[model samples]
Target: MWYQVFLWALFSSMFVHIIAALIAFCRLRKHKIGAAVAGLYRAADFEMMPFYALVWGVGQSIIVSFVSFTRILATL
Candidate 1:
């Protein structure tokens, strides 16, 4: 059960990260920010942002999953 919760949280975080990145990219492009401003806001390369976000999100989800599993265990 803990493993399942962890896996679910990891995948959900990845999915959410992808969607958020896409939306952010679209908004950034739509506004036509200057190259310098874009560079300042997004220091990392465009191709790497999504991967970075996914990794960060997954890390956060791991903590969340652990906490949730502990809570469930405590209730029983």
Candidate 2:
């Protein structure tokens, strides 16, 4: 059960990160040189990445746990 929770968190965080990167990349590609330079700086903005990942991971994990708990209760 704990392993399942861990995996859920891991996958959720990874998915969020991948989607964010793709979105950032797309935005960067769509812009002019100045915007592209700014985008490069944004892409290298590591300060918020970990916080975002942690928030998403924990949020997903909480949702998963709540759903599983309710399912267990229903089975009882």
Per model, how many backbone clashes are there? 0, 0
Sequence-dependent TM-score of model 2: 0.41
Once model 2 is optimally superposed onto the true structure by TM-score, how far is the C-alpha of residue 75 displaced, in angstroms? 54
Q: What would the TM-scores of all predictions be?
A: 0.44, 0.41
Tens digits of per-residue lDDT, candidate 2, 1-76, equal: 9999999999999999999999988887677996876677689884556888799799999999998978966776
Model 1 lDDT per residue over 1-76, tens place: 9999999999999999999999988777667556566676678655557889899799999989998978966777
Residue 22 lDDT (model 1): 96
lDDT of 1 at 57: 92
